[model samples]
Target: MPNIVEPKLISGNANLPLAKAVARRMSMHRGMSVGLVDARVERFNDAEIFVEVYENVRGEDMFIIQPTSRPANDNLMELLIIADALRRSSAARITAVIPYFGYARQDRRTKARTPISAKLVANLIHEAGIERVLTMDLHAAQIQGFFDIPVDNLYAAPIYALDILHHFKDVSDVMVVSPDVGGVTRARELATRINAPLAIVDKRRERAGEVAEMTVIGDVTGKRCIIVDDICDTAGTLCKAAEVLMSKGATEVHAYTTHGVLSGPAVERVSNSVLKSLVITDSIEPTAEIKACPNIRIVPTAPMFAQAILNIWNGTSVSSLFERETLGPIYEGMYSAA
Candidate 1:
């Protein structure tokens, strides 16, 4: 038999709670006894980041969990430093598990003299000695191509599907609304899963940090609309889209996003908007203001990510984790009780 290597999980300071949860779930998997690797990540008085791996990681497969969310630059630097530390420590392979990849919005240049920051970040990771990347619901699917290393970009559709089924007894009354033309593909997937029709919000951006105007493309009359997207920033777009849906006779509006990058006035906007609820995964750590917002609901992505990590470690296909049948038990046990 060939030599078998067990994977070691490590985490940066970006989101310790999420990392801990993933580690706990991995430990629960049968025939797997993986544990979180000890590490110290701190900052100097002037904010220079430092990382030190406490235990032996030599010749071991290592997975580092870190989401580049708020303070994107700081968190991103931390991830890179941690990956560099692992590589220098002689880890067999290093996979950066970034659940919410920041700087992904700039995957392309809309005009001249602009940089593709996403590709730059990808190159940085590659240069940092990472062998692979595991992320979810990238803003643009093409961003995966930016990385030369193998990247597994997972989807939150299955998780949203399970949540929809749990909340809506009659799925026929539901409609999935893409907040913009770019998100139609994502919305369509969820719509197909819930057996609902699709709608789009045609909106134009007048300038940065604002949405000029929006128009509803399909009828949402008398339906419970769920607006789907990958990221929720200032939420100007989503809130505006929800208003359009409501004006078009939708009874209620709900929003589901994989990463809740609720910056600026997002929480305030969502709280005052017509949206009945806003659902987001724990891919990014919630701020105190986010917790205080009653309309915001957080769903755990730990079980799904835990399973994906196991599959990758076992050299098995991770795609099946996105299937509802494969995730039925996990979804039922976790969300059905909520």
Candidate 2:
């Protein structure tokens, strides 16, 4: 950490813990004295949002940190209003530091004559006065191109790889598995770095919330399998993939997902599944049930995120940050690293 001109940081109600962690790693304590606008979001009789920023934000380098996770509409609107408030108050520059960008998966229209909402979200953020955008593991990398503003898409691969190495003494038998075909590239890169094998879960989506589990692509029998998915919404797919591998004679099964958007019944499914455990990054806030689950775990991405933020703030190269790896035991009280 070098001495640089610190910008005034501000956070919304989306995921304050993550924002605070980022601030702490950067050696800045939030809510010390700076007046922050209180986002009083309410719903009128018609169920429309009414947002207002309570404090002044005149002439400051404002960074609005909101993830737009569950209840995405509310969180997204909150960010828009916050940025609008800053703009009206004449903030020097506004940067939207979203830890998790919602609606990224809808980057393209899989069907005919449908809207590309991801691009629309990008447009809305820009119109809301965002000069730049910073987020992690967008569902589709191409979403970066959709925004004209300077955008940085950070990767959690290095952090995940390092964790895998430290967790298993000999990762030679560990198989980095992609839950579906699209994630093969990501899975392959991780497997190559750890010098481990790779596997793929051939699945057929019969319909929404229904996945038809096909055979495992590579040899995972009697080997440790680590399923990789960008985001685990219901935990159904990952859980089923893990079970399939285990049934196929896999020794153990673990999941490393970047964004843990565990919606309804996700925590319950993971708890009852045959998977040994799950290793997830704190990209989104986990529910109480998700935390209480025996097999579910969380790894903080604060240090990696902090370093990237610092690099951005200081005008340094952050591309090389992807070269590093994160390794450690995912088990609670076993080992922790970023």
lDDT of 2 at 129: 93
Q: In order, what is each prediction's RMSD in angstroms? A: 1.8, 4.1
Q: List the residue pairs that clash in candidate 2.
A: 162-326, 162-327, 163-326, 163-327, 163-328
What lDDT does each candidate get? 0.91, 0.79
**Candidate 2 C-alpha lDDT tens digits along 13-82:** 7888887777776563223443334556666898766666666556656677789898898889888887
lDDT of 1 by residue, 1-338 (tens): 22437888999888899998998888888556667898899999999999999998888888999999989999999999999999998888899999999999999998999999999999999999999999999999999999999999989999999898887778788999998898899999999998899999988887887788899999999999999999999998888889889999999999999999999999999999999999999999999999889999998998988888889988998899888888877666766642
TM-score of 1: 0.97
Model 1, poorest ten-residue lDDT window? 329-338
Lowest lDDT 10-residue stretch of candidate 2: 325-334
- By TM-score, the best candidate is 1
